[model samples]
Target: MKKINEITEILGDDTSYYLDHVSKKIPKERLQIPGPESVDNFRESDRSPQVLKNLAQLYNHGNLGGTGYINILPIDQGIEHSAAFSFYKNQDYFDPENIVKLAVEAGCNGVASTFGALALHSRKYAHKIPFVVKINHNELLTYPNKYDQISYGTVKEAWNLGATAIGATIYFGSKQSNRQIQEIAEAFEEAHQLGMATILWCYTRNSEFKTDSDDYHSAADLTGQANHIGVTIKADIIKQKLPTNNFGFREVDFAKYDEEMYESLTTDHPIDLCRLQVANCYMGKIGLINSGGGSKGESDYKEAVRTAIINKRAGGSGLIMGRKAFQRPLKEGVDILESVQSVYLNDKITVA
Candidate 1:
C-alpha cells in the first residue's frame, strides 16, 4: 500500500544503503514475467504433473493473485535457532497451530515448517495452504556448533503428510558438505518421483572462512555456487541468502579473480549483487527464493519491503520469510507478509 517514494522517505537519504541503493535501480520497463506456458514447460521438464498442479495452485493463491511468484512462510527456525530463541519474543508462536494460522491469515502462497509443526495440523490446514515440509535441520544446541545439517524425516513420510513441496538445508562450505549433498540428492530424487516439489536451503557455512575479509561465507560468489549446486541436484526451487558481497571466490585456492571481475560480474548496488545469486540458479530455470533473516528492531517492515523490492528487481522468485513474520504479534506479522506480497503484485515494482 505504500509507494516507493514514501518508503524511501522513511529510509532517509543514505543513497548507498540497501533501501536507497535498490530504489534507484527499479527498472523503467515492466518486469518480463514468465507465462503459464513457461510454468508448464518448467514443470513438465523437471517435475511431475501432480507437482506442477500443486505448484500452480500455490502460485494462484492469496494476495499473490495468481502471479506465479512465491510468498512462503517458513517456521523451521524453532529447530534451527532453538525454540526458546525463536518464540520468546512472541510466545503465541510457541503453539504450532498459531504458526500455521498466521500464514493462512496472511494469505501466503505456502507455508514451510518442521514435520511436527505441519503434520499435527495437516488434516485441518494442509488443504487450505500448500505445505512445504522442511525435512532436515541443524539444531543449534550442539557444542562448538558444527557447520552441518542432517535429515530428520524421509521423503515418503513427507508425501504421506500431503506435502506439496519438501525443503532441506545444506551447509555448503562445511567439511560435511559432500555427505550432505549426497543425502539431499537422494532425498530430492525420491521427492520428485513421489510428485513433490523440492526446495533447497542453499547456504554457505565455512569454519575456515575469513570473517574480516570480503570473501566471507555469505558472499554472493559462495552462495551463488550453493544455488548452482542446488539446481544440479534437481531441486525445483533454490532458497538462498540475499547476497551482500561477491568475494567468496578469493577465499579458496582453486579460484581467483581480479578487481575488474567484480565490476563485470557484480556491482556495488544491492539489487545487482542479488541478481548474481539469481543468475546462478540456472538463470531462473530453478526459482530463487531468498531467506528472510532475523528482524531488525522497529525497521522490520521497512527492511521487509526493501528486501522484497531487491529480490523482485533482481529477477528472483519470491521470499521465504521466517522469523521476521512469526516473531511479532499476529497482526504485525500479517502486515509484514502482506507488505512483501504487495511488492510482487504491484506492477510498479519491476525487474530490470
Candidate 2:
C-alpha cells in the first residue's frame, strides 16, 4: 500500500492545493474527531450498550481498524446502477461471494450491499467481517426513471442477517424526501433498538438544486444541511459526496442562508468546503464518510487518493468507496482500496 508521500506524488501539481491550505472556519479542535476510544467515551450516552458494541465493531475493522477511522466497501450498484452497468466489465463480481471476498481481501471495515447479496452468504462471512446491509435503493426500471429511494427489506430482516449496521439513502430536497425521511427515521430507530448502527447516504436530488453556473446537489452549504437532517434522524454515520462548490443557498435563492455562511465561514478551499460538511454532522459526533464517486479511468487511483486526502484533512471520517475499487480487475481494485487506507494510516496526514 502507498503512504502519504507516494499518494501525494499521484496527485502531481495539485498536492499543494489540498495540503498547504489552513481552514478558516470551524477549526478541527471543536470537532469530536475519531479515535480508538470513540465508543467507550460515549458508551453510556444516547446509544444503547448493544448499539455501542456494534458501532465499535465498525470502528475496529479493516486496514484502518482501531484508529476510529473506517473504510467500507459498498456494492449495491447491482440494484441502484443496474447489474449490467455495474458488473459488465468484471464478471467475478456477479457472484455475491466475490463481493464479500473483495471486501475482506481489500481490508474493508465492512461490506454494504443489498439484501439478496448479504443474505445469500451471511452465515459464511458475517462473523469474518462486519456487514452493513443497505435496506433501500432507487431502481432505474421506472418508465420515466424517477429519482426516489424505496425500501427493499426491513430492519429486522437486516438484523437477522447478521448486519452490524443498516445503510439507507435519503434523497433530500426531492418530491418524495418527506416520505423517505420518515421511513428511514423509523427504520433507524428500530435498528438502534435492535443493537445495530445506522448509516445514511445523505444526498440531495431536485432540479431546483441546479443552476446554469453550478449544481447544488453536491454543494457544501446545501449538502451540509442535508447532513444536518440526517443526523437529526440520528444517523450513526453519514455517507456524502465530497463538496464540489459553495454558495449553493445563495445561488439558488430558495432556502434561508446567511451571507456569512459563504463569506466568513467557508472559502474556496476544498478542506474548508468539506469542513462545513463535517460541522453539519453534529460537529463530528456522527462520523462523516465521503462517497467514492464514479471511476474516470487511468486516474482512478489518483482521484481516490485525492478524495481521501481532502476528507481526512477536513476532520471527517474515512470513505465508502465502490466503483473505484470494483470497476477494474480485482487486483487493481484492491490496490485502490489499500491506497486510500494508507492515507488514514499515515499519522503525518493530520487534520488541516
Best by TM-score: 2
The candidate 2 region of ten consecutive residues with least summed lDDT is: 36-45
Per-candidate RMSD vs. true structure?
3.0, 1.0
List where candidate 2 sits over 4 angstroms from the true fold. Answer: none
lDDT, candidate 1, equals 0.79
Q: Where does candidate 1 clash, by residue pair?
A: none
Q: How far is candidate 1 from the true structure (C-alpha RMSD, Å)?
A: 3.0
For lDDT, the strongest prediction is 2
Q: Per-candidate TM vs. native? A: 0.91, 0.98
TM-score, cand. 2 vs. native: 0.98
Off by over 4 Å in 1: 1-38, 41-44, 251-253, 256-260
